[model samples]
Target: MLTSILLRLVGWLGGGVFDTLIGRVADHLRQKASDDLVRFQTGVQADTQIALAQLNAQIEARKLQAQIMEADRGWWVTSFIRPLIVYPCVLHFSAIVLDSTFMFGWGIAKLPPPYDGYEQAIILSFFIARPFEKVARVFAAGRT
Candidate 1:
């Protein structure tokens, strides 16, 4: 009689209402454990796959970070470094410097100085590293 009364009281309080909820939770836990066990049994391949996926994601994130850093580095290197390195080395290597604006008259007709073969490189890099360019534009427009 006592056992029957206690069971009825427990059922009335929550046992009946929570039975399906408890079962669902247990099912989810079981599925997760089974998946983890399968993954573990796959040995190094599973770990390697996970690590490779993470590294690929990191590569993309690092690329974006690199762009941010490049933008911050600004235009000094682009303007000065490329010309200093390229004009002497690539354009007129071992040749005598006949003029400052044009070296040995071996330059383009209207391309001007430092605009040989790498003008696109100079222009693109110049605009890409443009944190100072922002300041210059603001000052030029007299907005600041």
Candidate 2:
């Protein structure tokens, strides 16, 4: 009788333990599935946001191009503008060179403040402006 009672007690305890272990496993699986679903939903939302941002940037770029086209004046008026501005600076440089060669040991022709500023500005624009513009466009693209 004692042996039979001991076996019965062990079987009952084992059955309860097995049931509890199964319940714990089911709960863990359910939690893991829930977590995975949330992650998937978040990723989908992020992808949608990125797509929208790209579309908006494209729209803005198109608008900028349209504005530039509208602002363009005729070629006749624009063609002479650069030459008109640059010719005086060239003439001034030539005069300075002639004065220095003809009048050695005398003072060099001093550049007027306005002309000096203009010369520097023109030189800088000629050398570095286009590269700087390209870098700016790259940075702008990254931001978008």
Candidate 3:
């Protein structure tokens, strides 16, 4: 009878200990799952914010491109119109002056030919003006 009672008591204590351990394990697992869920939510929020920033950047870039296109159109119109109005008038004026000077004989012949510095000045002016003319040609090409 004594042996039977001792065995029964040992069995009950062992069962209680096992139940307590199982409860602790379940609690630990629940805590870990809660932490994982929080981390996942935080990551999702961060990703959403990043996506929104990227979308905003794309919108701004498109706006800038539209502005640049408008400016380019304005430049194109001015480039064509200015040369159209200015070049022929300037050519006509230069031709008239040359013709009048040649007819009257009161042109470069009236000025004393520089015996010393004139030749150098003419050469230098020609070189400087040539590059300017090439630059003007480049601008004209852009218009067409």
Per-candidate TM-score against the hidden true structure: 0.25, 0.41, 0.43
Question: Rank order by lDDT, top first?
Answer: 2, 3, 1
Tell me the number of clashing residue pairs for each predicted model.
0, 0, 0
Q: The CA-based lDDT of model 1 is what? A: 0.62
> Model 3, residue 119: what's the lDDT?
38
- Scored by TM-score, the top model is 3
Residue-level lDDT of model 1, residues 1-144, one tens digit each, is 999797578767877566777688899999999999887889778888999999997887666556655665568767566556545443442332344445556543434566644654654554565557755653444431
Q: What is the lDDT of residue 95 in candidate 1?
A: 38
User: Candidate 2 regions off by >4 Å?
Assistant: 1-13, 73-144
Per-residue error (Å), model 2, residue 25: 0.9
Per-residue lDDT, model 3, residue 92, is 47
RMSD of 2: 10.0
- Looking at candidate 3, what is the lDDT of residue 52? 100
Highest lDDT among the candidates is held by which one?
Answer: 2
